[model samples]
Target: MNKRKIIDRTLLTDLAKDVGLNASHLEALGESCQWEIGVDGDMLERLVEIQHQFERLAVMGDDEYRGFYIEVPRPAPEEWGDAEELIASGEYDSREAFLADWLAFNPMETRWFHVASNRYGDSRSIRVTDRKHTHFIITNHSKCTDAEPDDTWCRENLTRLFDYLQRMIDVIVANPDGFNDYVAHNLPYQQRTGRIAQKEFNRIVPNCKIEVEDKETAIKALEDSVHGRSVPPLETMTIRQYCSYYRIANEAYEAYYRKRGASGRFYEDPQDVPEELRDVAYYKRIKFVDEEILYDIDSPEDFIRFATDHYGELGLSRLNIFASNKRQKGWMIIVSNSYSANVGLAIEVATALYKARAPLLIYDAEKLLRILLEEDYVRLVPDSYHNYMGYQEEGSVYELPWEYECSEDTDSVLNKEQYQAIISNAEWQPEEQAKPIA
Candidate 1:
């Protein structure tokens, strides 16, 4: 698969880069994004919604209309037939009819005969120019007519066109991370990150995994195995011969090694046995069971999707979700095949399942984002002054280990002016003047 490329852009930054147009036009031009999606398609889709605005500037309801610059080439003097003869001959009609005939009767001269529309005279043609200046208006109807250099053209018509362009730029650019974020929202409860150390076995499985976090646990586990701390050797085990040697009941065997087999869930209650002794065996293993593990997961998002899709029905219904950055590659390991029902799913998996059944309520998006992204500013005072020294002032300082332990209320972090500024900005966000995007 090809690596995903993330393209991030803001339209205002982009509008500045469109160097072809002058400041007059580009100054008011809004921004847009079209992340691999065609810009033309996006623009056209939005323009259809605001066609009603075009009528606001019309002199009369435009029927036969035009709105683009065209070369007004003078017809050759030779082709300019006698106006008197053409008029009296009953060939010429009104001013509009005469204008149409003038263009048709004239032969090609290759002057600045600009024609933006291929189907000009009688048909409808709409266009939106980029980086090039092309603005014209001609119409037989009164409602759609827009005469240049007039208030109607300035206020009603031009504003509407710029307004339409702004809407197209507001769409955010799509990226690969967006897909990951999307998957996170839709992820099923069963596919979150999990740990393998949380299982329980009810039977005597020959060999299984033992959980170890750091060097301390590993070292202790190692010491237990070498010193035979888990179980007494058969020779040292007095249970078998206890009936002969001690005159005690034969139940001595079961009593001495009570729950030693652990019914196989050794991790749950080793029954005072060392953790390294996950099973009756002396070997330290990292697996929960002896069977072959088959669930293969790649990315965190893929893990969620696959696990949720095949939860419980697969041989192994649980998965271990390891956190890794990009460059990792997908499989869902189910837990059913773990050979025992006592093996448990990781806490994250359980949390995910719980969330699936009862999702969290998001009352405020801004507050949630702030909480997620905010960093704590810890005030570590020097050891010399101690707790009570700096807190002489009313609300300037927060003493540690006492006020913190007591759960005392904190004073406002912002000063009066700072608070006022922040409050004003918050209140003004929606009221700020923005070029209309409709």
Candidate 2:
């Protein structure tokens, strides 16, 4: 890079000599610097496009979003007609005077969108994710841990979607030029591997050395990182892996109660979701207007709130469902509340009774346990992104696994207020109405 010629040569020479910087790294670093400086041909073209976008937006006035991103690493103040000579000559003495001039001259500073223009799709939000933003996070248990679950509900409308996915991945594999640019843009501000494409990024970029304690080890690791070519947290998923992802999202939409609503962000219009899969809202709504539905329970707390409101009582206990030979031994769940509650649970020994359809969530309860209960069971590293204290399974979280055990007296787990309240009442309405078992 031309910048390297003027940078501290002695320091560069020492680092290169010490680490034995290879030719590939040298070239990569040079290209990275060039991108930062706005020299790359594609980047230059993009800059022009961005400027045109700004001009077009400015002409539209306040009817729509008239504001635009002032390009990253904005041009010098002089470029915006702010002459520094005025300040140097004392023409602008106080901070107030300088800011007044800036606000009057800097279009980027003065520009803003109308309040009505703040609606969704009016302006783009910067997001860094590997998968398409659309997702169905929950699913039935079978699809949760299963890598390749059978596709049972391939509705005709979804054909366009699958075809689009196939075409998109084909482009990524054939030439990841756009993908590389996106990763490079967020490389500095994101994790060591950038926001997404993290595993794919590992193949080239060097690991960060900021937190390494041992000086020698840090240098050696950085040197090896750039030079050594290998895989590293999650490699780019193969077609099988991508299919499993599709399976989970797809099944979540179809499994269980087959409720009418969908993700709120895109619910406004099915047409907006280009390659239409299914009319998430319109299809099944009028089907069961009279049925008692678990309308909007998005989380455990929401479930607790609904149960408490409807049943007038809550309790807790254990339920273990055993499996056949060569299978997982059993699955255990914390269940129940105090006996007198009117709420009906489906299983015997459960509280709370519902006559109508209640939707089931497609979820990996095992993985979800690890995420939600991490404070209780997962050990923390003092200064790390991950909770595990050490590499692999060597940590307190793994060593002392936690499972909820019903109290001998109350048949409930304790600590949190909700859990505490569930067990406070010892009396229950009896198993017939209680619908509970351990």
- Best by lDDT, which number? 1
RMSD of each: 29.6, 27.7
Q: Write the per-residue lDDT of candidate 2 for residues 1-438, one digit (tens) a residue.
A: 011122122432333333333122222222332212211233233333333333322222332322211111112344334556676787888656776666544323111110111112322211111121111211111122432113322111122222322332233233334423333332221112112121222222222101112334323322332343112212222222222222222233232113333333221223543333223222213122211244332233332333322221111111111111121222112222221111111122111111111111111222222222231122212123222222322112111101133234454332244323322221221111100011
Best by TM-score: 2
Worst 10-residue lDDT window, candidate 1: 195-204
For model 1, how does the per-residue alpha-carbon lDDT over 1-96 read when each residue is reduced to its tens digit? 223333222232233223212222321221211101111233333333333323222221245222221112233332345655676787875545
Per-candidate local distance difference test: 0.25, 0.24
Number of backbone collisions per candidate: 28, 23
